[model samples]
Target: MKLIKLDAIDSTNDFLKALSSQEELDNFTVVTAENQTKGKGQMGAKWESESGKNLIMSILVKDFLYDNEQVFNMSVIVSLAVIETLKSLDIPGLSIKWPNDIMSDNKKIGGILIENTIKSDGRIVSVIGLGLNVNQINFGHLQQASSLKVICNVEFDKDSLSFLIIEKIKEKIEFWETNSALFWKEYFNSLFRRGIPTPFKNLYNQNFMGIIKGVSSVGKIQILLEDDSVSEFDIKQIQMLY
Candidate 1:
């Protein structure tokens, strides 16, 4: 539970990864920053945040995973952890967009980027980076973005929120260690737009209609096609048009 607070950084995930390489870090070591110069999201998208307005942090989880292929399991654990934290705050319409985007009322409020490294000795280390919009209001042209303050009409304490989320993550990690089936069930139930026909786009920007069934075992989205065929698509191959 070692915590390091920073005024700003290039990316908390990068910083923690570098730190872990140089020295032995305690499990659940956390690094939080007020701002990120090169904040990033899934698939190399830029994550922009207002200074001192959000939860920008990365956590180091050492040797908890059995192998590198279980990254999606880690994703599920962390995603549910964030959702539980937000739900405890009474945030309405909380759902997980596939691959781990936190959504409320169909707008994204937070996101997760997990970076895993397998050491030479086969120890799997994960650096989980989370960005949650808290008090910041303006998103410029990003229409599908909103924050806790915007959704609930009340300001939030970033420190308290960060602590709660981290604690929830720790709890979920413990829970998932033995109750993987139950946690996966929770994930499918909390999935956004499940069982409803939705528009999706392919890599070439072609639109199609599909219903999100659930995620595949390999971490891809499972969509029921228009012709009654269920297909799995990687995150890079398809984009949900909500």
Candidate 2:
């Protein structure tokens, strides 16, 4: 639980990755920035956050127990941890969108990006980056993005919330070692719009209605289409439409 706080950084994940490569780091070593100049999202999108107004951080998970193939399980663990942390804060309508977007009332509030380093023998060291909109009140034209202040009308202490989230993640990792099946079940049940008819557009720009049937163990999204057939898609292969 070693914490490193920076006034600003290009990206916390990048900094942690570089540090880990340079020397052995403790598990759950945290790096946080007050202003992330180049915060990243899934698919290389830019994560916008007002300076010093939100949580922009990365946690290094050294000696990660899971191998490369169980990366999705790692996602589930992290997402669940964030969700539980938000719940403890009394944030309403919290749900985890597919992959790792944290949503509340169907709007985006946070996201996670996991980068893994694999040893030749197949062990893993994971760098888990998370961005949670905390006290920021404006998203400019980003209508789908909201923050804890916007949603709950209350400002939160960014540092306090960040530490709580890290603790929750550690708890999840410990629980996962003994009860992985339970974790998977809870992850699916916490999915946003799970089992609900939703609109999506494929890579070809074809729009259709489908029910999110849950993600595969490998992290592919499974959808039950209008034709009563099932299809699995990788990230960006299918887009969820609001």
Candidate 3:
């Protein structure tokens, strides 16, 4: 694991992507910053983090063995790794919201954004950017955000947490390379609100109650509705209501 630590950066993901283009980056190469001025979330949303108060990093996966279609599996692996790391810290109510948001007690504590590079022959390289709230005690007006210090009443060593999460991610990646089916099963089981009837809204603003069935191999969410019909949705097609 080649790690690059920065005091601040525009975005860890952007830095890693730029690095990959300039030179051959080792697999599992990581770029982390104390402050990401332009951190990103899913769907081009801005990720807000206080300087030196959270985990803001991006990992480069070069020469990935998986094909382009299995890119969703990489997201699952990274999400599970974050969940496992938090669990090891004795954090309660750990669950992964669909796609890649880390939730605890119904509040988001972290998120992930994955960008893929495909070659002419269809080989893939993934740049995964991750942000996790650590010691931040306030979210201003963001009511649904929480951090480790707020949730567990303890301050944590950010470097130590970063190392543990990276290690867990590498472990998941190794396991995924060998036993993908088993890893997928566990990923489904770790989903937030899995099998529970929850309120959801569509892009058209239609509201409905749906049970979280599971995610497809390609990362579409499967929701079973009250009408006994199952529907599949990609990100941004449907919104989960808290």
All-Cα superposition RMSD per candidate: 1.0, 1.1, 1.2
lDDT of 1 by residue, 1-242 (tens): 99999999999999999999999999999999999999989999999999999999999997678775677998889999999989999999999999899999789999999999989888899999999999999999999999999999999999998899889888888777689889999999999999988999998999999999988766889999999999999878999988
Error of 1 at 177 (Å): 3.1
Q: By summed lDDT, which 10 consecutive residues of candidate 2 come out lowest? A: 62-71
Clashes of 1: 0
What would the TM-score be for candidate 2 when compared with the true structure? 0.97
On residues 26-118, what C-alpha lDDT tens digit does candidate 2 reach at each position? 889999999999999889989989999999999998654656568888899999999999999999999999999999987899999998888
Better of 1 and 3 by TM-score: 1
Q: Estimate each model's TM-score.
A: 0.97, 0.97, 0.96
Candidate 1 residue spans exceeding 4 A from truth: none
Candidate 3 on 1-242: residue-level lDDT in tens?
89999999999999999888888888889898999999999999999999989988899886654576778988988998899899999999998999999999799999999999875666688999999999999899999999999999999998898889889888887777687888888889989999988999999999999999999989999999898999999998999998
TM-score result, candidate 1 = 0.97
Better of 1 and 3 by lDDT: 1
Model 3 misplacement above 4 A: none
Badly placed stretches (over 4 Å) of model 2 are none
| Arranged by lDDT, best first | 1, 2, 3
